[model samples]
Target: MAIARTWKSHSVLPGFGLALGFTILYLSLIVLIPLSATFIKSAELSLGEFWAVVTAPRALASYRLSFGAAAIGALLNAGFGLLTAWILVRYTFPGKRLVDAFVDLPFALPTAVAGIALTAVYAPNGWLGQWLEPLGIKVAFTPLGVVVALTFIGLPFVVRTVQPVLEDLEAEIEEAAACLGANRWQTFARVLLPALWPALITGFALAFARAVGEYGSVVFIAGNMPMISEISPLLIITKLEQHEYAGATAIAVVMLVASFALLLVINSLQWWVSHRHGRKQ
Candidate 1:
């Protein structure tokens, strides 16, 4: 009994029970309570009514665009963000700090401001827009514009997620692989990739989640065209404006469920990859 008391007093962090209780209470008050209210609001609709609200043609189109654009944005970020992080970590050049700072501009910029700036730059009469219009490319006020806006906002998530991982990795690993008669591609594919997989997956998931829930950054570029460029979040807001509270809550619930499901899958994948890599090492 004396030993048990000593061990308990010497624990690395005291009051685990207090901390756990506080965490549960905080989450319940801030997250669980609000989410439960959404379901309660939505439950006013009958089963068929709820089904129709979610499955309506307009809602379906919004779902497609929101998820599709978010996926595309996340994918593009996963590629370019990795490259950005690599360059920052692996090389030194003129204005390197400037470039690094620029990577985070999106995070600091307001979403509405981002949407407006992108619209101006991509509008048909604007700077790059004038040059691209003749090439049959339209960005402002279109679905493509939505993708651009999402990509802009989501880039930071990927870069920030992977940057630390890349920094922690030693460049000598690549040199070692080369000394073993491995080609560059082989070195990267077999040596660097496995270590980077978990971080990349996490970055992708973060960017994807951010893009899915994004509204202000997309609304201006999307042109708010129903069934074409409208996003689900925008649709929910519209329903709320129209006093269709139940419908709005229903849509919100669907988004909540779907986002949770996708995040869960991505997190599971990250865990599996990390576990496998650990076993191999």
Candidate 2:
């Protein structure tokens, strides 16, 4: 009787074991195993060696540049993405569909091609860069160029993530607020912004993550200047090129941990926002 009951209960959760098995195997193969291998390799380095690998003045500078540009780019994307989504959702104009399609260009275009195009356009000898050169605003092979590349890649993440949420939002709520004597700014601030906050955070996090690991598009325009415009991913590849596997893995592990921590912080913020939103509801 007991065995039969157990079998029946298992039938109720028939796929439970299969699901768990699949999840564990998938995670191990894809994430945990690869990361564990990195740790194993990194562990071969002494503490001093690990520190030296990660904290070389050049490496540290690259870390700062990579993370800083990604943060700034994410922030810029959040603001501009919101504006872009609002425009796409709320307005209809000539070339609207074309403009919409263009938003995905970053996603479709090869990163190397994008890099070359961006460098050409921003180099002092190139079209727009020619005009800006007199102003001494050097865009190519500089930190500004890194930010530009990160921004270019991250923009789509934000815009696309936020678009559907914006589309699904009810205009009636904003209209009610306006009809009840609230001004445009007030309606947006007090009524509309809260609902969009979660999506914005999600989009920002997605962009930030994507930008942090970006390499190809950044390399050409960054000029690979150590302690200047070089990014962390480039540094990792540099280590690999020199056959310093331990050093490469150490840096990779650092990046992995930092990225995980960042997403954790963002998740906590998401939870808080969601909790407050639920309370308001």
Candidate 3:
């Protein structure tokens, strides 16, 4: 007798087909259609008009502040987040669980509340700010505040992204490397770094993307100083409030394009790393 083809016999595909249908429909309604509307609205602008809106000095400044601070914050997180993940994974101490739970505070805290709290803490007259301001270190209502807010929200991404990879890492390799006379730094650089590299990159990309369009946590602290501490999302809102829909969409389109290009590059890097790792395996 022939062996049974169980998947064919059960006719399970109908359920899967139904699930796939709903998934696409949901995505179209929520994501695709809205994005398509942005593209449509942007298409109304002439090429020169589009360029004028996107490349104007004020708009360019916003892009710099947004992407620049986000990149910096993400880089910081990648380094600190690795240490945090290592602490959570490699050891146990009193309050270790509490520290692990604290990592998720940003995720659970309302963005507006976090923004308010951060502004209060960092504002010139606020608690910590009182000390820093005397030394001419400005935090709130400046670009530095933007970096702080971005760092606050972006950290959880790096920590969460890296934690899982750290957990999955086998201790045996480290032991063997040590047994073969590898120092702690030597073993980590040679063995652990390669496996965690992809996770770190992914976390960095996640944090960057989250910080790019962040509005709620940034707006209250940014002071919305035009052409200076202003961010792109605020600019879009300002345009909308002034009923400049076309200008708003133009900026949105520029961000969409730039973000797409950035993500594509990051994804390509991730793919190369994964592929190379696979070949070694």
> Which has the greatest TM-score?
1
The order of the candidates by lDDT, greatest first, is 1, 2, 3
Each model's TM-score?
Answer: 0.94, 0.92, 0.90
* Ten contiguous residues with the weakest lDDT in model 2: 1-10
Residue 281 lDDT in candidate 2: 50
Q: What are the root-mean-square deviations of the candidates from the true structure over C-alphas? A: 4.2, 5.1, 4.7
Q: Across residues 65-146, which tens digit of lDDT does each residue of candidate 3 receive? A: 9999889888988999889999999999999999999988988888888889999999988999999999999999999999
Q: What is the lDDT of residue 8 in candidate 2?
A: 38
Per-candidate clashes, comma-separated? 0, 0, 0
Give the distance in Å from residue 196's predicted Cα in candidate 1 to where it truly belongs.
Answer: 0.6
Q: Give the Cα lDDT of each candidate.
A: 0.94, 0.90, 0.89
Model 2 lDDT per residue over 1-281, tens place: 12454643555656888888999999999989988999999999999999988888988898899899999999999999899999999899999999899889999988888889999999999998999999989999999999999999988888898899889888898899999999999999988888888889999999999999999899989898888888999999998999999999999989999999999999789778966763465
- Residue-level lDDT for 204 in candidate 1: 97
The runs of at least 3 residues in candidate 2 whose Cα sits more than 4 Å from the true structure, single-residue gaps closed, are: 1-17
Q: Name the lDDT of candidate 3.
A: 0.89
- Candidate that would win on lDDT: 1
Poorest 10 consecutive residues of model 3 by lDDT? 1-10
